[model samples]
Target: MALTIKEENQFKYIDEGAGEVLLLLHGLFGALSNWEGVVNHFKSNYRVVIPLLPIYDMPLKKAGLDGLNSFVEDFVKLKALNQMTLIGNSLGGHVGLIYTLNNPDKVKNLVLTGSSGLFENSMGGSFPKRGSYEYIKERVAYTFYDPETATKELVDEVFETTKSIPKCLRIVAIAKSAQRHNMAKEIPKIQHPTLLVWGLNDTITPPLVGHEFNKLIPNSELHFIDKCCHAPMMERPEKFNKILSEFLETRPNDS
Candidate 1:
């Protein structure tokens, strides 16, 4: 039978590579395509699995308000997932953290990059004041260390993707829904070896949040990538891949 796991919603994904499994999850408005570079690099030596989150190519409502939790349940049904390594970005990172906390037995290592699920009010917090184009623009601008890197093409792509979502309110609604997960209390529950990656110029989640996570999550190491932004895997594939490879080298066998 083909590699497949059933959850509440039928999602698309990639299950390639061999040896210890490494599950990758992407952020909002992201799909399996987000980790194309990372998956290509590790597929030779590791079993890389990328789940196409429900919100991709669809409206936020389609992903379900509790989609994150539902996705984790789907992962549990995958018999190959026992004691595997997990790497997630943005919203995916948040879900990873939650999974690790509730089902530590399924995770050997956790890697969160420009992660979310923390900062209860980050998207709506006082910083940017939430739900405004200015907030989105400022957050996007802050994600990159070099503002010049925010090319018009990139900005337009983001806007277009958000517009495609039904009702066009999933962006804010997802952010609001994520606030229910309090990382501050959950951080202590994550005991597996963890690696936190941050983009120095990140404005959306900010580098300071990474530092905060490092301090709160015991036995976790933080790596700061200068000249990078929100999506390091896409912006600096070489460096991001190298860092991930090095981290995996030191971890105990996932088997």
Candidate 2:
């Protein structure tokens, strides 16, 4: 029970369990809860850490790739985390990719879900400018294969979170920073074993980008979840967990 509840920080993280560490980074506009279900699944076997990433609603924390990367690096050193299996979704994936590239020795395995660093994504046209139920509902619709997942409760939750101007500004900075990334050239240089899981119907990052990452990252494997959108962990947890478990449990050179 004590291990289940996360202590607060803008970079708030929930840490639990023992053995190897599985650090999870959720997609943009996501909180620790986004990966809570996944965390619970692995907590008994792995030391799971899911951080509440920079969000539009999070106060004071300025958002940028470098800033986020610095935070993660510091988090690693402060926690004395080593040989971790990094699992990230979307923007989180992009951050994890950059961190892994810079510190390959620290990462045992890398798993990215609909990652964003491989290619440029022009997905902004789907979102509205304000914090309204309908506006957030529409935005949430774009992240999942089934529109029903973005329920009114979810919309209300998202709307309440984004009701600040400063946070929205932070979001803009993060988005711009994301577009500035072109890690494709460096992807081949990453020697760590990577697993790229993508949603076949992911209009946000798209499957084409997954194909590109698969080609770029050597000693890598790609798995596509059918009928899924931006988030396979949320949309198809059973299949997602199975693939993730197999990948994480395997040794780098194991056949």
Candidate 3:
């Protein structure tokens, strides 16, 4: 389905269906399309919302996890969203961690997949290389265990984004910031029931990162999808959504 994007002031997001809210956040090189599977599957029973994080457009100075967290907070307030099932991927997960830490009351549950608050081997240990479609293609393909998941269209989109020097600069800045901002000490304080879904073959964040998250967060569970890599929702949507669905259904009731 072609999702309709709602524009309010500087924020542009997709809010669909109704009931409980599932506010999703995407990663550094991610778009609303990244959560397409999750949105489509949950929209029937839950209100699925995804805000476009200003990764490429934000001012270079504020192009980090903190900046993205602030954007999400403003968007949440603008939409009057609360008690949301906050879901994030990659850098988006990093942003969600910060947002939940500050506004624990607003979030009813947290879901992180290949999040990067602890450690990440960004872009396979290097920044994006401009003017090289092959390099871009390889990097994009590296995100999934199956290289075929990296379609030409997806590769083209990323290649186009990297062609611009300004966007690359912002990407690097945000990435570096994520690496610097570790949440080990802070994540333990998160009282919300958290779910950590990771890819067994994920080379970027790796399986260890997911285990670490489970170890740090007080109320959290970890699940790994075999033969999957960084972006599980995109690569293994069925499994990702299934795990998420079960978690939401069996979530512990509030005391």
Per residue, candidate 3 scores C-alpha lDDT tens digits across 1-255 of 778889999999999998888999999888899888989999998999999999999999898887888999999999999899999999999999999999998999999999999999887224646889999999889888999999999999999999998888888889888988999999999999999999999999999999999999989999999999999999999999999999999975443
RMSD of 2: 2.9
lDDT leaderboard ranking: 3, 2, 1
Instruction: Identify the superior model by TM-score, candidate 1 or candidate 3.
Output: 3
How many residue pairs clash in all the candidates, one count each? 2, 0, 0
What stretches of model 1 exceed 4 Å from their correct place? 1-9, 56-65, 76-79, 120-142, 146-157, 165-167
Q: Candidate 3 at residue 243, lDDT?
A: 97
TM-score, each model?
0.80, 0.90, 0.96
- Model number with the top lDDT: 3
Q: Can you tell me which runs of candidate 3 are displaced by over 4 Å?
A: 124-128, 252-255
Would you list the C-alpha lDDT of every candidate in the order shown? 0.72, 0.80, 0.92
- Weakest ten-residue segment in model 3 by summed lDDT: 122-131
Quote model 1's TM-score.
0.80
Worst 10 residues of 1 by lDDT: 120-129
Clashing pairs in 3: none
Q: Return the top candidate by TM-score.
A: 3
In lDDT terms, how accurate is model 2?
Answer: 0.80
